[model samples]
Target: MLKHVQVRSSSSLLRPGGQKADTLSINSNMSFCSLHEPALSSRSSSYTSLNETQSSTGSASVPAAPPTTTVKVYTRCLRPDLEYKTMSVKYTTTCRDLVDQLLNKYRMKHRDPNLFFLTMEVATRSTGTAVRTILVLDDDSCPAQLQACYPRADSKFTVRMRHGGLVKVYDSVLMAESQYKSLLVSDRTSVDQLVQLLLTCYKSNESVHNYSLYEVCRTTSFERKLHADDRPLAIQQEWSSLAEYSFVLMKRPPGTPRSGRDFPLRRSFLQWSRNRELASWSGREISVIEERRSKSHRSPSLSLAPARKEGEKSFYI
Candidate 1:
């Protein structure tokens, strides 16, 4: 009788620790020795394929960072002195974005973004005179792109408060003689609001209604009182190119109309009076007068009073 047998070789099978065993089995019709070898190779290939797929998928999902640029921003509106700050921003950063960054850097994040803007100052020498032209950039405009437009001129970027312009506010009552405050204003800000702001800045307990804002032009020697509903910023912008304008805050004159016809003479008189008062009370004169007054007030009748020096005289004599 013919008998059928099966044989298996342990050398081709993966043992518990992936070691080859010294055992064999024989099969007459088929060979089972390489059966486990294919299974192990297939599993390894599938695992390698899975790891590659995972790596490719992870690399494809992540995004690359955009390019950045460095810019210098001059900030003159935040303080009396000019300041410049350097920042790292994206090339596509807009004027509005730069303004926000500047405000945040200066610890003024709580302020309104609309109150500030970016400007480009182009300084050129024309007709042997130095001329400067300031152009206000739109909020959507890109600062980095605009800077590239002017390659030869001395151009600089500055952050300014969105005002008609910088106006000098003279408050003779609150401030010292010939001293004034610089204020930034918007075109829509009215005289009443400006007066209130000035009062708040000076920390005065006076009523806003009692004060009036006057526009004084030194070049034209003209003066006018601004109405409550009048926009001082707009007026300033209009007269900006024509003359040097300043704002004067003072008490509202009684029985006087808002025409401001006689205000100039009144202002002059007030200035003269102030000058006279200042001239009459000089530092040396004040000290001498104070000394005489102190001596006259001292009691000469006191027996404990020390005798006067050789050159000194008693107030009673």
Candidate 2:
């Protein structure tokens, strides 16, 4: 006789003190600005004239325009084909203005500018160890100024989609074979809701109960089976790097026990969710299974191999 397995909904989870998850809050008032290129030639001429006048008379020269920095912003959530865009930004450039420039560069139209936001990846040294962390920048925050503060540390900027919050989801069984799909969600959006959205995107008619979502880190070989009541977007925001870790959709192993006792409260995440501080999950290291090489490539010496092997897997599932 087969024993039936019980399933729990996302709403059943409780907070630290036994409270419900917070309501969804989406920011739809993000304003768009037109791109305005600074006239460098005119500024140079003005500076040259000021230097001549200063030489002729012992008068003080005026300060030049704010210095600008060249930066590249990558975006896989908006359009996968278009990887990144480069532009010049001054110390006063805000995150909102950066998004406007990217949209203009891509010539994207009819899309709500409110659904996009910027995130930065910073690598800092602590106790002689390198630590990388991702930060979701605010509309009023200045990326150029922030980079200047961390001149010694490595910094990278990426434009991500976020209404409530945008999360990248993978549908493959292996990391090498996975391709990401972006979904808009909030802290209130449960794992169950994410599964439904993925189902609709993939056009799968399978039972939602038969599936499970796992947070997998390919670099560390660490994976955690997320609870049905878990908020995926909130979990993603707590991660260190999107490239090293991601949410993967997989089939639930048969007869796997289900319970909410092991899951943390969604409200607890609010304490460190969007803060500027760094957060990383520490899990026991696990061993990875290496793929076997063919006889022709058995030798451990260098050889002129094709860019992609004949049997290599595709990026998409």
| TM-scores for every candidate against the unseen true structure | 0.37, 0.33
lDDT of 2: 0.66
On TM-score, the candidate that comes out on top is 1
Q: Write the residue-wise lDDT of candidate 1 on 1-317 in tens digits.
A: 23478665567666799787667666566434545567667877999999999999999999977678777888877644758787888878998898878877877643546578888987778899978899989999887777677653477888877535555678886666647776666666577767776776666778777878777657435556666777666565544343366778878766765444422332332243234444656687656655765878852221222333576521110
Give the per-residue Cα lDDT of candidate 2 at 117: 85
Error of 1 at 48 (Å): 3.3
Q: Over 4 Å off in model 2, which ranges?
A: 1-63, 164-317
Could you tell me how far off, in angstroms, the CA of residue 293 lies in candidate 2 after the best superposition? 68
Cα lDDT for residue 20, candidate 2:
70
- TM-score for candidate 2, residues paired by index: 0.33
**lDDT of each prediction vs. the true structure?**
0.66, 0.66
